[model samples]
Target chain A: MNIPPAYVLTLSGILFALGVIGVLIRRNAIVIFMSIELMLNSANLALIAFARTFAPAQEALRGHVFVFFVIAVAASEVAVGLALIVAIFRSKESIDVDEVSSLRG
Target chain B: MDWQDFLSVLPFIIVAGWATILLLVDLWIPANRKGITAGLAVLGLIAAIAAVISRFGIEREAFDGMIIVDGFSSFLQLLFLGVGLIAIAQAYDYLRRRDIERGEYYILLLYSLSGMLLMASAGDLIVVFLAVELLSIPLYVLAAFAIPQADSEESALKYFLLGAFASGFLVYGIALVYGSTGTTALSGMVAAIASAETTPVLLFIGSGMILVGLGFKVAAVPFHMWTPDVYQGAPTSVTSFMSVGAKAGGFAALLRIFISALPGAAVMWMPLTMWIAALTMAWGNIAAISQTNIKRMLAYSSIAHAGYIFMALPAAATPEVAPEAVRAALFYLVTYAITNLGAWGVVLAMEKAEGSGLTIEDYSGLGKKRPALALAMALFMLSLTGVPPTVGFMGKFYLFRAVIDANLIWLALVGVVTSLISAYYYLRVIVVMYMRDGEPEVRSEALLNSTIILTAFGTFFFGILPGLLIKMINQVGLLDLLR
Candidate 1:
């Protein structure tokens, strides 16, 4: 039994939307970071699905290579993101995004 | 990769390798004398600038078409290198005064600069994505370089979260684009689009997503919420560098990807970009009027300028105006970078150790206290307002000409009106500096003064004799391959 490419893409798209919404509503820095991770994972999933769909073409392999690149970028983002959060947390004693506002118009 | 491939990316290699080596070298240097690291970073940038100059007038694809060494890339690389040099100069004294001077500052700047260099040369979507991340990660860290400070760390967190979120959108867009086009190479995507039975919906949606991602970087209107906060909260040196480097990098990719690869879909995207440009200009300039903090005001002003640069995109949709539009955009970017940096340099000079001297009121009596510094600041303001006898005016002239040539009369009108609105605020700074009476304290360091003088001279000299710059920009062939 084979799954349709549309199904995979649809699932990925839904996950991405959820991630975006999570980022919008969430106040906790760590949870927002998790949402971002979900967004990146959904992108990776979509890339794999596309790579498989276009497997017959020579350029399709780039999609697979791109997935690895995205994974690496996501990992680096995690390192940097966590460090920034920790630094902010230390200063404010809270990880709530709204409370971090010392700057405004 | 062949020797030729390596040669093509020599500038990027020199900076990246030099920075990595410097990271190891910095361990031996003591904390108080981090000036050595700054000097080494300047030398590395000078070497990279020499490399970029050598590659000028030569265009070729390298790394299996993932990168293209062209006039476009060479020009932007030189600008990035120049920005790096000035950033170091600005940071050295300011960091020392604030007690934030460290060897890592220069290393991180060099790394971020290498990413910008790669961005200018990227020929593939994959490389574009990688370059964006490479350029941004260092910036995220650098925004918080003044560690233990609440404002700096908060700014970094905001910048990182938004930056990562933006990249997620960018990558997902690339995946969708790849799914429909079956290629990630820019040239390959073009060919695929030309041969397809119907233009794919996924391609349009994907490009839209890509626009959203880059819009955040360039600080366009809808995506500009983070600009003021980050610019205000980050250290002055980082804010100045980020304002120029990151915006240009975003535009570099935006122009290359959209104009080079997605021209087939211009009919759909053109109006969208035009509207965004207009909205960005109006919002930025109008919002700038009420800002009390100088940094936040400039943040809004930079957003307005992004809108101006963005006008070139829609104008380029007209095939006849395409190359001219590109030249105009590049010219405007050069002007903006020079003027903005000088303005920030003046700000840096006036800034206090504890960051209290940043409000617009603090600039009062600057003319009475420091005439030369005040004069440079006034010149920067005039240039930014697109006043005559300054590079900013010439830049706006050429940009507006391109817009009018492409028959974007309404868009051009929007630009003119917003520029008018922008003058009200920009000129207010000049007013506060010259007319008001108060003693303003400023640090007079040799390096920072020279940077201010150099950029101020460029702003004025280029405005008077723009023909020299225009002649050089005309030589750059933005769409030579397609032609």
Candidate 2:
């Protein structure tokens, strides 16, 4: 009951807001990608903090396990994402998302 | 830890294993022989399906409640494998014709299929996130598979950026829910919510954020800006696979998470989903009528269909109507899969080697030149429009029935009217094919694949015998799961 849920939640909110802002304002694809990672890492922090505060030890382990999975997935996403950026660079000569609107009507 | 539990997930393991094996084989095999890799991937999927059926009705859980093997998961797993099979087969001709055939594409697809299967069985929020990432990461690559095409590469980058952002929302929601309820296991979360001393505002926040994330994946309106661009830019085969398979997987995961885990707070989530459903239907239908590009039209139509599926979510949240609503949703999913895939198959067939022929004008006079393709396309369009004597009609019927039974008369009526509006655009394709005139040219001999033809035939046949499919769906014990 004494755990600082407010602090953890506030951190998550800050991270999420940063991600949204990055998505909205950034024209570079890689910067936007990094912002997303920042958001996910913040969420992981909150999840682990909450698990430690309220859940019993055995059950709390699930949150850590989930973190591991998230990391694995993040790695996979980076691999695919970097490859795509390389592909885009080869074609468009730039990684600016705004300029990549060639498919738009 | 029993073998039975492992067996329940054997199909997933097979696909994952095959993907690794193919990666290694790609190093040895000559580039021109990459078609054999696609063939091997298809065999792996077929064997996986066979394994799933061989263990049908044998319920089990694996890894200490991390995964559940039941009728619902099994049915969806089979659906995922079936989609994978058809997609790989379609890609063989699609990639080869374009001279971009690569073993990595098939391997990535197989890996994605494995992820979807895992998603279908995920019993915990942690597992759900893992499964979702597994399913999404490969699709990010597949969306931009044609690196030579600037549009394809652009689509991939855009999808990845947005997809990663959505995942952030999802994980943030999971964190809040865990904070509020003190558990990540879905069933455990439910119990925690039911027993909590006070209503958890954080839980509601978590649920809302998660809904936004999943909504993006399913291409529900407002969050659907990515759909048309990504679909139009990705290779046709990948778009087809994504439009049907990825949406189905996303819906399954959403249902499991929201309906099962967050039932205690239905009032919080149901209304938000209702508005999303209504807006998606209206926006998708309205926009689609104006689209001249076949890929973009299908993309908008896909959004509208997502709206129809979303309509079932509110009803499923109602204690009195939850079971029937879930069933209707699941049934509608299956029917949508058939029709959507069929529609894409026509698009794939018409596309020239360089992936041209996507405009609505390109389909002009198609009926006169390619009678069989034309007929199949007409049936698919009818099915999509929810016309009578087609699976789409029955799907709409069952979904609306459950909606009305829940006393959501207005929503059901809105749904009906939207279906009518949607019919116009769906039928427009039929009109073009039959009523217009041009010298349509059919390209690949592989277009006459027996499997594609059979798939189309089954779509029509199932429309007539919807009862059989419904019965099979009901046998999946979704009602028990709801309870």
- In candidate 1, list every pair of residues with a backbone clash: none
Cα shift from native, residue B261, model 1 (Å): 0.9
Cα deviation of B199, candidate 1, in Å: 5.0
TM-score of 2: 0.97
- In model 2, which residue pairs have backbone atoms overlapping below 3 Å? none
Identify the CAPRI category of the predicted complex in candidate 1.
high
Interface DockQ per candidate:
0.88, 0.77
**Ten-residue stretch with the least lDDT total in model 1 chain B:** B474-483
Candidate 2: stretches off by over 4 Å: A1-5, B197-199
Deviation in angstroms for B141 in model 2? 0.7
Q: Write the per-residue lDDT of candidate 2 for residues B1-483, one digit (tens) a residue.
A: 777677767888999998999899888879889878888888899899998888778776687778888888888998899888888877888888877788899999998899899998898888888888888988998987888787788778878888888898898888788777777887787788789732478888889989988898899988999999999999998999999888998898888988888889898999998899889989999899999999999999999999999998888878888888888998899888888887888888888877779898898999989888889889888888898788889999999999999888988988989889988888888899989998776764574354458667878888899988888888864654564
Leading candidate by TM-score: 1
- Ten contiguous residues with the weakest lDDT in model 2 chain B: B443-452
